[model samples]
Target: MQPTSELVFAQLKSKNSNTRCFDCDTKESDWCSVSHGIFLCLKCAGKHRGFGVHISFVKSVTMDTWQFKHLQMMKAGGNEELHEFFDFYELGNYAPEDKYRTKAAYYYREMIKTVSEGRVLDREKPSIDEGKIIVEEQKRVMPQKVIEKAAEKDPQNIKALIGDAFEYTKDLGRNIKEKVSDVSIADVENKAKEAFSKIESKVDSWNFKEKFNSVKTKTEGVYNKIAAKAKKAMKKITEEQDFDDSKLVEGEDELMLDPQGKNGKK
Candidate 1:
């Protein structure tokens, strides 16, 4: 019996394979290039489409209707398999200027050529034993700190770390506020002054007088530039208002002096 689309998707998700785009490693890839057998993000998929059907036949995993045969083929030819085949010995070292995009395109072209010429290897389905070995190897090589962090549910996920940091800062602020709820404004000011005094004394004792003066001079320069801009803006506005007021006063005086004016004649 042919494999269903649901079955194929489940298999891919279980392996955590193709969760990221093959080109840029962007997460939550929604598109797949059938010819190259690699998952891609929307932007990368558009690039693949530009290569035409002969090069890469792109499809949306969610939006497009899938054929059983196509699904079976995808299940057999996953992203990891395609990557291993195309990036053998990791020959495509991406330069800073190429930014992986060029390398990705090259791999796609190579993969398409391999598929069309029947040079593609037969990929065996990953077994439970292989999965266990991969996990064991990762645990063996990973640092103690990294493993502990992962155990705390803070793996090397950048987005998650950023979110955690934001939340931590917010909680810290809230805790500080609660702790200082009963403290008077004067007390807080005194505490701040004491802290600055200690910092200044330490800086002086450290013989960092030259560095401190340099920093102070730079800060003063920035302040002066900002003050100058503000003064210029205020002067422009005052001059404009004065000009308008003078014109109004001149018009009033002319009307008062003119005998032909109705109010003046009265």
Candidate 2:
């Protein structure tokens, strides 16, 4: 059964759509050579048009009108199918120069002949289990462990590890030197000397002798006043001590002195 236009367009715009030009593999292909059922970039499409309509009928995906037959042809055959059919033995290996217009034209001509003969028009599809077996065989041929061991045994890998370690050590040493240089012994000594000089200057500015003399004079004055008071109190106590209770004059009570001699009153 023929596929719908929607299904055909959906396949074309998919992420896994044929993004590379079939002839050169240049990315962002916007054109498709409808007859050959292959995608092509603008540059490659122009070259295909030069080959003439009978050889390569080119159409733009965005601008061209797609008929039901055109869409059916695209659905039936795509870049992968065409490539597999043309390069069945995988012998048509094109070099860089072969990817240009002239060489691509030759392949397109050969493709036309194959299409006319209808060799790849309705080939049988491979079963899912067959595809799985093919994948498993590829894995068996080149195991992941083998590749890993090969990389580990490489001399370049060892040299790279050693180089990285050396760079790390060099960077660490540079950082340590930078930290050490930030603090200098001479700078510390200069700061200490400046602080000591400030303290000595402050001490020199004070009038210590004048202050001491002033304090001593005040202290002597206070001591004299205290001595005078004590002497007066003692004299009164001795004079009173000679008198008995009968010797006390009338209206006079016995004199009493505080033990501290701070106060003397009758």
Candidate 3:
């Protein structure tokens, strides 16, 4: 196969309608015809094709050296060898053993590795940082309007939270409904007993009365409607059944004729 630089030169040369690589077509005009075949012009030939490396002894060059300069700055900060390697690249100079090029590639690999690790570590523990951020946010004092404004600015977050809450409640309801539909009356009573025990534990142990009261106050209107329905249901059930243990334990009183009655009257 042709060398990478030769391939690039051929590709660029094919850019011109009037020009074609000895083996292919190109439309670019910056290619020069050498003895054996077409070659890249001085500028294109010296610079790396799409950021690989530079070829020495091409003539005039046009590729920006800013990235190389920035690399130099980084080397100045702490990478001494980086500076030397970059100098080698910038001047189109290479050692006989490819030492400069190898060192530069090594440093580039390390930088790439460092960046990759940073990204992986960042995503792996986002929630830890996020928790700290949320805590700081909670500590910050702002007007209610400001809080609402912030939420409005990030409407996607608000929408996402609302969607999450809706999905959670919907899933919960579906699960409970499915369980209720499949259970016998006895199972319903057992589950209700378990739920009551859990509620009692919460009521007895949880000390957030202020928080509970605030929520209760906000939901008082809905609570009133529910309470009314519950009272009506309780009243209906009580009317159909007697709660007197005496009536059940000692059957209902009966009046009989003198044959069996204590008062011997007809």
Provide the TM-score for each candidate, comma-separated.
0.36, 0.34, 0.16
Instruction: Identify the leading candidate in terms of lDDT.
Output: 1
- Residues 144-222 of candidate 3: C-alpha lDDT, one tens digit per residue: 4423543554443433332332333223322322222233334433443343343233432133333223223322322
Worst 10 residues of 1 by lDDT: 131-140
Candidate 1 vs candidate 3, lDDT winner: 1
> Candidate 1: misplaced stretches above 4 Å?
89-91, 94-266
For model 3 the local lDDT of residue 205 reads 17
| Global local distance difference test of model 1 | 0.44
User: Can you give the lDDT of residue 63 in candidate 2?
Assistant: 55
lDDT value, residue 216 of candidate 1 = 34
The global Cα lDDT (0 to 1) of model 3 is: 0.29
Please state the error at residue 231 of candidate 2 in Å.
99
Best by TM-score: 1
Candidate 2 overall lDDT versus native: 0.43
lDDT per residue, candidate 2, 1-266, as tens digits? 75655577677657344778887787857777777777887666655554434456667676556777666556555777666644542324643123222333344444454554555534333332332221111111212343344335443343333233233322332222222223233443343334334323433213332322332333233323333333443344332221111112321111111122333222
Clashing pairs in 3: 14-25, 14-26, 14-27, 15-26, 15-27, 15-28, 16-26, 16-27, 16-28
- For every candidate in turn, the CA RMSD to the true structure comes to 27.0, 49.0, 33.9
Worst 10 residues of 2 by lDDT: 131-140
